[model samples]
Target: MSQHLPRWVLPGAVITVLLLSWSLAVHFGHAPLMPSPWQVVVALGQLAADGRLVRFTVASLFRVSWGLLMAVVIAIPFGLWLGWSHRAERALGPALQLLRPISSLAWTPLAILWFGVGDLSAVFIIFMACFGPLVVTALNGVRKVPSVHLQAGRNFGLSTAQLLRRVVVPSVVPQLLTGLRQTLGVAWMVVVMAEMMAVNSGLGFLILDARNAGNRYDLVVAGMVLIGLVGLGLDGLLRRVERLPGLSWGFPTARPSAAPAVARLRLLRNP
Candidate 1:
């Protein structure tokens, strides 16, 4: 199995070994608190059979989707504006910097007080978790756009809106996509915590409920595994989008037919 396989095979093999070791350890240790992998698998199957897993997963996904959409819509424009205007960045940068260091869990008390333990509270928490980094990323992306492109757009007698639409937005798309991917990852990470504290119907709540109802460690582990797998799937989907032809403008790809100028020069000299 180790001999002639591709590089990706090693990671899967490592994960399998780790899982087998974990299952063996739990089985032999007889630790009632930790459920074996097989127990978690059985519990997950039971959850699916009862449809609770699907319901809870969908609830969490809904919150994350809405939260990320809101973050992207608001953050990108504000960041673009901020990047364009030195005055605006100076005015808001300090405040944002102050707030960015605050952890999402730190807002749990205020989230509960303001929204009172519901979907809104959970969504709000997820939104805040994603917003700050996204803004910063977008601003950086806009700032990184080349001055030549801006000058070229202006030379065409473009209006401010036209310049943004034709020049800035297209140039920033790659960076924005990168930011979006990072923001969504953080959003997913925070949603579970937010749901646990602020909502009654998500994968996070399922884990908490499992513990409280009957100390069901198997169910808790099952919920954790589902969250991990779903997050991985979502990220994989986003990676595919990032590699799409139109969206992947700034990414490096092989140009099989083209040789480097230095290589061409050397070949001509030798020939």
Candidate 2:
């Protein structure tokens, strides 16, 4: 039997084919609106040579980092408290539910009014985008912690503080990490949108600037590609951090080794 192709290989092939097709289309069309891949590369190089790319990128990175960090600091504590205490959850549930559905963009006007048009307003947008998702995912992760573990902690005469620190917190870490992954994406997205409106520097501002300066389509496309690539890299880094041996200890353990035939069968047809 032929071995199955690796999953990564398929995605790589698809991307290569799509980019080739796009480049050929642009070359044939010879339109400024649709610059060829080579043109985009050249544009990127020119921008980098002028130092504009690095400066804008640093500005965007700082906004995202600060906003995401603030979100985590607030969300994790609130989520854990709600998950641990019924009273807190009951009190906060209605307000959280109300605020969670509001789009991050909707907060832009108020954010501008409160923080003015600058880094503070941009960061506020990112914070709002990251906050709701982080809180919800954290609550889910913590609430889903196995009851048996808590029971065992109680059996050992552990106080509430000890039980939380020793058992509950560690058990819920994977879920928290997963939440962070999602929040990080939202934070990145919000940063770009916020910058387009509130800030005079960053990738979002650069994209708008390129558009206003007349058909700089290559720059707009390059900025979008940069955002997507950076987001993917950040999530991959988080996944690697979570897979560290000690970090995985509280995570579910896999069953011991099975026959190769059984493993293949299970993969093909769940039992």
Candidate 3:
């Protein structure tokens, strides 16, 4: 019965505890830097009343969506090709490895120089942040596809393209989904940073603007809360995708009977 409880219960409890602790700290410590959660909530309400919160959130979401779309389009095919051909992976993998370690924030100066402190600059930073992890994950998924599956496809007289489309792609979908979830988190973080420094309109800008305008720590905290909530919602949506029937092959499903059988087999082997 306990196991059947909603998955979110634990997380909700944790968040509640954290928020209570934050409120207490703000009240007791009288720290001007940290606003009580209620103050942030009120600030968010005021922003909503003025319509700035919606505008900033939408702007940030638009940049992230466009950047992620572009990264997915370019990375998938290139990763597949690299995984299929040893020569390509060998030739290109080193460069990717070297570049992957460089933080997306490091690209801000160059992005500003090239795109000139606007939506394009922020989008470019998000693209760079998402691209590397995506390519690496896609390549790994392709390379790890079972050779037996490929052989079976060949035995059925499928051409290389047919085998790839039918077998290789299906096998890679689960891992790709996992990679996308992770890459999206990185992209979200990058967009906020980019917006703070390179762009004039976004949640990040809201945080900075609030601070600079009147030292409104409450509004700054409000912006931070909004970013976290939005990121959580985006991740939750992707998690739902992973549970879809077609994508469930990538995730483990509960099987009580199979677990007992596995335990029995293990006991028999040990005996």
Per TM-score, the best of the predicted structures is 3
| Top lDDT hit | 3
Off by over 4 Å in 1: 1-8, 251-271
Question: For model 1, how does the per-residue alpha-carbon lDDT over 140-168 read when each residue is reduced to its tens digit?
Answer: 87787666556655655667887777667
Model 3, 189-271: lDDT tens digits are 88888999999999999999999997999999999999999999999999999889877663122332334333433443345
Off by over 4 Å in 2: 1-11, 28-32, 251-271
My TM-score estimates for the predictions, one after another, are: 0.88, 0.87, 0.89
- The pairs that clash in candidate 1 are none
How far off is residue 157 in model 3, in Å?
Answer: 1.4
- Model 2 scores a C-alpha lDDT of 0.81
What would the per-residue lDDT of candidate 2 be over residues 1-271, giving only the tens digit for each residue? 1258776887899899989999888767757588777777888897799987789888998999999999899988888888898899999899999999999989999999999999999988998898888888778777876665566556556688877776677778887887788788888888888888998999999888888988798898878877787788989998898898867555342442224323332332333
